[model samples]
Target: MVPVNPDVTRFLHDGRLLAMPRRWEHRRVVARWLAHATLPDLLEPLGERELTDRLSELAADPVGARRAMVDLGAVHRTRDGAEYWRTELTEYDELVPDDAVEDATTSEGLHRTLHLDGRRIESVATFYDELDRVFMAGEDRRLRPGLDALDDLLRGGFGAAHGADRVTVVWHAFDRSRDALGFAATREHYLAMLADPRFDAALFRGRLADLEAGRGPTYAELVLEVFADHPGVELLLR
Candidate 1:
């Protein structure tokens, strides 16, 4: 059963409705604005006619305009030649704030574990935590037909590792799934960590399946295996 928290739902609904898409677009524009142009070597101010024309052209046929802009040297293009409004010129440093990076990382981590049910029932505990994030305890499992049986089997609790935080056994039946599951954690960091060569979802599933089948390693062994396979497990297991 997928349980919805009324408070969270209401808050999200209000936030979405109140948010201005245009404001977000403006923010992007401001964040990416360039103080100087590459071509002509003039102190090119942002929003000048030439730049606006270029921006408009780019907006209209973004793919072609981007290529043209790259050729003009007005903007630095990525390896893929996607033009970005030049911010800082440092080669090694990120232009965006560290908090934004952290947030993106947390969001990626949350998304990876979400929507895990349609595939094989590899890690019941892992799958359960993802679901619990969106739904409250005693909530109906929304994705699968055999949820009640699964919930009963799991006894309404699961293991979740908050990012760099202590491990906690969360009751799936609780109302505060967000706090308990670390839903606010940065997904980008989580996903970046998963990029490790040894990280294997297949292996994790295999171990989980073994545990479920009564022929697998103990939970401790499986956890250890996960840690061994993924150095990033420290992020999740901490």
Candidate 2:
């Protein structure tokens, strides 16, 4: 079931209507609540244009709502701005202040995770916090610095140091971002890609560039480089 505060929903018409509330406090609550309401529809990757169009369909001010999603860490986009994913916050039920989340997301403690490989990710909790800032609720050119950090980390391998369970957590978050931003991948294809012996961050970025340049490979083409084989890949585009 979708989670939304009943009282807060009323301010925004049960999440069906949009109102830019006059009060800062009201705006904050409603925007967060709307982010919650946006979950079900965001089950797949969407480009920047696509996401905004969807948001515009419902809200009077689509830009504000879209920005709210990023600002609140409710959604994450790839560093290239080519894809986005909804984050599954472990503590989604908790009542965290918006200010607190903002403060936490921007705090610097991850400078050390860079330039290491064949080692367990030293700071798991810290990694995800920063990861969300860049992926789930990030915006502006502000994303580049974090993206560079991510590339350096991924150059070794995503969740590589962590193994399947840990990879699964961050990967699931990343996978969801793909749903919103990257091309579509079925559960089978996605899991296969995750379980594959190797994942190339460089290759991943190349595909992103292709996506942005209008000459990108289809998801089927992506599966080839990312995995040994994905059956019915041919049927994916038809």
Candidate 3:
């Protein structure tokens, strides 16, 4: 469930923010929320386009939101506007005025856990399905069953994390997932990707060949590779 605090959510409707708050106090709330929500890797600097694209997922006026965050000291950017990073929000906590604003999602110390039962994954399809179900908390919206969707889902700001401070994903029965998504499943996965015009046919063909020779990474390993990009998310394989 999303961490709900009236002080922070008064500016939101559904999941997307309704509007960038106009009042200084109200704006601080929204800015602080964006600082926590938008960036998946706080330590890495993002190009303007990347940062704006991430922000666009949460607000209609991403450009304005970006500017507001910079102005409010919630984010920092290069003078040339080429790169950006989230700023520490500890100083702003005292300015919030409302004690109730300390919600789980915004609390830096709070850590949440999400469990992925690998015992339930029987195939590549079941892997994505179980992932989507667990991450979305059984809500509407099935993931595309592809690496792109997996990246987005793990990045937070929606689904399970929903802007939470930190998330620890435990993949139980991981050995089962490894076997279920092993050689055959990896070959099948690459073959399907090879069929798509958007993918590099040559590269996928090479991967398929490697799989046939019993030398390539399994589908589960690929999932681990993607998880490596998100340092904020701790992935525990059991």
Candidate with best lDDT: 3
lDDT tens per residue, model 1, 1-238:
1122333233224222122123543322222222132222211122334554554421443344334444444344334332244322221222222221121122112211111121212233444454454333344544232235333322324322233222212122222322322322223223433465665656555644554566655433332344354443221211
**Predicted candidate 2, C-alpha RMSD:** 18.4
Clashes of 3: 0
TM-score of each: 0.16, 0.34, 0.52
Expressed as tens digits, the lDDT of each residue in 1-238 for candidate 2 is 3455655666655455566666766666665555555544322346777777767766888877877777666676666666554543332333222221211111111111111111221233233354444233333332222234544433333332221211111222333233332343332333444455576655655655666576775442342344223221111110
Error of 2 at 104 (Å): 24
By TM-score rank, best first, the candidates go 3, 2, 1
CA lDDT of every candidate:
0.32, 0.43, 0.73
Clash numbers, per candidate: 19, 15, 0
Q: RMSD in angstroms, all models?
A: 20.0, 18.4, 17.0
Model 3 C-alpha lDDT per residue in residues 92-176, reported as the tens digit of each score: 2232122211222222345556667777798899998878767875467778888888899888857876666767676767888
- In candidate 1, clashing pairs total 19
Best by TM-score: 3
Which of the predicted structures, 2 or 3, would earn the higher lDDT when compared with the native? 3
> Candidate 1 or 3, higher lDDT?
3
The 10 consecutive residues of candidate 2 with the worst lDDT sum are: 109-118
